[model samples]
Target chain A: MPTVHVQLFKGRTADQKRAAAAAITEAVVATLGGNAATVDVIFHDIERHDWATGGKLWSDQPPAPPTPAAP
Target chain B: MPTVHVQLFKGRTADQKRAAAAAITEAVVATLGGNAATVDVIFHDIERHDWATGGKLWSDQPPAPPTPAAP
Candidate 1:
């Protein structure tokens, strides 16, 4: 049995997840030659603050503030 | 370099996650002999409703209601 774990940002709907799971299962079965029914695709939603790249958290990215009107 | 992806329920504090990451990194380095810095332990916090087992969603489990005594 192949267990596929997906790590992604939170906020996806159930339909989206279901579709993704189906696609992943199909692909794994096709590539690895196992029954699709046996494959498990689990999704893990990561909060932006908890995920970091190159020692910097995603949530720390600077936001673009609105430009001030000329006086 | 080894990347460990942990799938678990939501509600872990930052301190808990930090401890887990450190432990995991150390273990990976000891077992695989790779630089600890290169080892990544990413956490994916999942809601109970999003996770399932044996075709049943975990959130669907009936909660134990308050016990009522005979009047």
Candidate 2:
């Protein structure tokens, strides 16, 4: 069985998770040709305190400047 | 950088996690030859309801039969 685990910052709604699972499942089935039933996508909702990048915790990172929307 | 994700049943102590991270990091560094500082082993503690095998949730599986001790 092919199992995929995704760790994302928490607070996503169930709809978002369901959509992600469906899309990822389709991609896995298309690429690997496994029964769609056997493809499992497990989401780990992570708090900022639990994740770090470049030796710095996500919670402690400086605020990112806002990006302008395209006209 | 290679990122490894491990999904395990919850309730492991911090010491167990530290040991696992150390061992897995060592193996990855040995085989892949990356800086040990950059090796990340993210653990996702899965609830029985969140995991399934053979079209059934782990939470709903029948109780496992006891195995006799082997001398």
Candidate 3:
């Protein structure tokens, strides 16, 4: 069982995330010899305010949050 | 600062991992508005014996490990 955890800055479409998961799962199964069903992918979305770089906060100049997840 | 940890089966080239990291970092920067330098991607190679799913072990039917990372 291979668990892939991806922490992104929290502004991607569900379709993008799903595609990423599928691509990663395929890579694990074909390249790494992992069972497809056993491959687990989790996504953590961080708020701009919660993310930082070079000791600076992203929320300080936060880009407007993208539209909510497509319903 | 966001740190992404990926637990993969213990057999992939360093270059492959590096590529994966770069792609992910690009996605984070472009899609999620994260800084490129601050994106950290860590890969943990787990022994098949250490991984399990559906109450079964991966090591029991382990596929042979792949070639070592390119020098």
Query: Which window of ten consecutive residues has the lowest lDDT sum in model 2 chain B?
Result: B49-58
Per-model TM against the reference: 0.50, 0.50, 0.59
Worst 10 residues of 3 chain B by lDDT: B62-71
lDDT of 2 at A66: 73
Report the lDDT tens digits of candidate 1 across residue range A1-71: 78777788787787667656666777777798866656656777889899888999888977448667455
Please report the candidate that would top DockQ against the real structure.
3
Q: What are the per-residue Cα lDDT tens digits for candidate 3 across B19-42?
A: 767765555444434456766878
* Error of model 3, residue B55, in angstroms: 5.4
Interface DockQ of each model: 0.11, 0.12, 0.24
Candidate achieving the largest TM-score:
3
The worst-scoring run of ten residues by lDDT in candidate 3 chain A lies at A62-71
**Which parts of model 1 have CA positions greater than 4 angstroms off?**
A1-71, B62-71
Q: Any runs in candidate 3 off by more than 4 Å, and if so which?
A: A62-71, B1-3, B13-40, B54-71
**Would you list the clashing residue pairs of candidate 1?**
none
Q: In every candidate, how many clashes are there?
A: 0, 0, 1
Residues B1-56, candidate 1: write the lDDT tens digits.
88898988788799989988998899899988979988889998877666644333
Task: Return the DockQ of model 2.
Answer: 0.12
Shift of residue A3 alpha carbon in model 1, Å: 3.7
